[model samples]
Target: MKKLNVTEIQEKPEGFVASVKEELNVELARTLKAGNRMLVDSDGLAFIYIIEDELDYYYVSFGKGTWPSLKKLLANQGSLDLELGNSLNIELTAIADELAFLTENIEGNSNYGEEMEKAVSDIFL
Candidate 1:
């Protein structure tokens, strides 16, 4: 599977979450329109979590898929209850290996890393 380099959002937690949603929505639309099946390993989710990890932008607390899942919290408002539990534990693992290529490929060439970062960052801001 190919990897996606998502830009690291250097802003407040809310900013990061909003940015992820916006990026994901756009990418999802584009991917679907292109007739590409969006597997868990697709670039869209990878772009989301990798940026989340790099930013450490979790509002309550930063975890693996905290950013994307938190962004999803609003849509799943009923899921989260008076007490946070399993509902809050959104799985970001599925798409993680997708981004491994971005991190791993840096070993061979520095320019590739720079370009990848730029591509991810340009997804939004």
Candidate 2:
């Protein structure tokens, strides 16, 4: 799947939402809720636990100070669904890129690792 530019995402909400649901095995309601949470907050750190939880199902390994790194990995993986490919009208690419960078460049204690792990487990339960 080709990586979408941010503009393509903003212009087509239905398509974007649909693709995310299909690829992530997430319902539209859940995706929308998560997306809204991401949008309302500028810091990706707030979403670390959520993202970590989601990734657990895929068996991806994440390390301390690796939240940003994981975002980059997801962005690189990109979307394979056709609906999302067509809905590329928003600035989501840049937003995604920024989030990836933030995640990759973050410097701090690794205490959040356990917290994120627990949060992921709880959410999945």
Candidate 3:
């Protein structure tokens, strides 16, 4: 959650490493302990923070550039697939289910039901 300025990042280049060390308190044996180069795709329109641990590679997104790239990639495959929409719908459904369960649990249980209802309504709205 630490917001680093671009100049600070550019000056150190290892700013993320330092941030990680300070935040996570991990002492790396060597600088190479940090794996994979940070990449900014096209003028900082999109950036990726990649880390590799053993045979596993993980990427964390800090911005919204991937969506257009993903859409383009999907389109190139020659279909207007609803996969993304479906995934979002599934997640929303899960949230709705959880809200319903919480509502049932709060029924006839003092002010809990009102609070739960308000929270669920706010999220849905």
Candidate 4:
């Protein structure tokens, strides 16, 4: 795997795009820490790789029933009816979701062309 620094990911994420499993899987795993974010995929698996950390990352898999709530909680960065753990976990969750969004949209092709403006219609009301 091509280990990438945060900057490299930010500048050119497309370079890392590949098969979902190959893109999300890591060789080594680590414990989640404060300020650590997750790299998530459509499969509901989340990976963690902090700065200067190994290419492999600590990961957690969520079930279908709960994954959506967790994903939403992280994306919104707000408190929800769901309960997981301490403030640190909540914070980390939020960051993880953000990272997942970035990876999913850029590397996963979840939002391609969504930002582009639509063509004008000649038959406007």
What is the per-residue lDDT of model 2 for residues 1-125, given as tens digits with 9 covering 90 to 100? 11111111211323222122233333421332122112111222233212222323111112323333334345554421223233431112333454444444333324445454443333322
TM-score per prediction, in order, is 0.22, 0.24, 0.22, 0.31
C-alpha lDDT of candidate 2 relative to the true structure: 0.29
Count of residue pairs whose backbone atoms collide, per candidate: 2, 18, 0, 0
For model 1, how does the per-residue alpha-carbon lDDT over 86-121 read when each residue is reduced to its tens digit? 222233332323333443443344454554444433
Q: Give lDDT per model, in order.
A: 0.30, 0.29, 0.28, 0.30
**What digit string (tens of lDDT, one per residue) describes model 4 on residues 9-90?**
1112221211112132232222323234444343322233332223333333332233344444445444321112232121
List ranges where model 4 is wrong by over 4 Å.
Answer: 1-32, 42-57, 74-76, 79-100, 103-125
lDDT of 2 at 10: 18
How many pairs of residues in model 4 come into backbone collision?
0
Best by TM-score: 4
Query: 83, model 2: CA deviation in Å?
Result: 4.5
Of 2 and 4, which scores higher on TM-score? 4
What tens-digit string does per-residue lDDT give for candidate 3 at 55-79? 4443333233223333332233321
